[model samples]
Target: MTALIMIGAAVLPSLILLVYFIFGDRFPEPLGGILGTFFFGVLTVIPVLVFAAPLTEVLQPDLLAPIARAATEGFILAAIPEEAFKLAVLVAFARNLKAFDEPMDGLVYGVVASLGFATLENIAYVIGSGDGWLSIAILRALTAVPAHATFGAIMGFYIARAHFEPARRRSMLFAAYLVPMVLHGLYDLGLLATSYSGDIAWIVLGLGTLIIAVVWALRLQRRLRREQQAMLAGTAAASLAAGPHELRG
Candidate 1:
């Protein structure tokens, strides 16, 4: 009974975010988004579980002692498998979809997929910890929610750019994929550092990364708005110019 409650608390907020991302947009509607997000979430867990052992073996030897010590249970145990799984899910399920219509839609769908992943993942974490509901709720709200959302938003931004600008699609795709990896890597590194050094600095670094990600996302939104406005203005101007010629013809 207690465990179920704890799991619910952690998972509910993430679920709300998922609902908003799916239903809030003026796109195809909630059903497809829900299906996409949920399917990706379930599918990602398979590879994560299957490759867990090999990934640990490969990453463990190469990692620095401090980081290794921090991840003594295993580096891939927490970081690589989870991140790779999320990325794969996004790529497989959401990318190249026609429903990804507007630039901001990238952010929306990516976030929905991520929230689905986070919800299940958080439920697992809370249930495993055997911690009280309050702790689980607070921890997920503070850490997991933003982290997953940011990663998805980052991916979505680049995916949207790639879709819109065919000439620069490859570069945009690269940035979209690489940026989230860097953010995820840095976040894990910070956790590892904190464990080894017992320094609060690592926590600060992780929080700082989240802050930076949010700021970057906001800037992207604003930039997209400006670009959209410019496109609309251009279209209107072209239409107006063509009107005079049509009358003469």
Candidate 2:
């Protein structure tokens, strides 16, 4: 029963966020494509775990002091690799779908991949807690799960815009990777630093970073949604004027 509770606590948050992100899409992507993306998203965990091993060994590197080494763990080691892999999956797998016609699709699929990774990641974290598993599970459900979703939302916003705007592709792609990477790194750093210093302020910094990220992503999503709604209206108008049977892509 405890094992089941652990799994539930881990899995439920991601599922809730996944539904929240995708449910509002005007034209949804196929169920199979979404599932496949989620599958690949879950697979991203393997590489992240493998990469963390080497970084752990180098925790006391010669060039950097322990403090600096600790700092780099958040931004350099954790953020960069994790965001890079998630973005790769977004581009290679999610972007290629026939239905990825608008910015919304990018946002939707981004949440899918991120949540998939979150669900699996959470299970491990919660289950490993041993005695205080419930607290860990609840805390992460509220914090980590939402943080990841917002990150994905931010990534998808820029990448999807890049898809439709060729002139700004270079900058868009740069923001797509960089914004989330920085946010993620900072969030991790707050937690890590708190561990070392025993400062509750570090927890505030981390949660503050997450709250800011969430707000930014929500605003971006709303703006994107409005833009797409206008596009839909225009397309519908054009289609009706053209003829009844004239299909629009």
By lDDT, the best candidate is 2
* Model 2: lDDT to the true structure: 0.86
Q: What is candidate 1's lDDT per residue for 46-117, written digit by digit as tens? A: 676777767557666445576565554333465556656666665666765666667877777667666767
For candidate 2, lDDT tens digit of each residue in 82-199? 8888999988988888888888888888888888888898999999999999999889988999999999889988889889999999999999999999999888888877766676
Instruction: Report model 2's TM-score to 2 decimal places.
Output: 0.90
Q: What value of lDDT does candidate 1 attain over all alpha carbons?
A: 0.69
Q: Which predicted model would earn the best TM-score?
A: 2
- Model 2 misplaced regions, further than 4 Å: 60-70, 236-249
- Taken over the whole model, the C-alpha lDDT of each candidate is 0.69, 0.86
Candidate 1 lDDT at 56 equals 55
Backbone clash total, candidate 1: 0
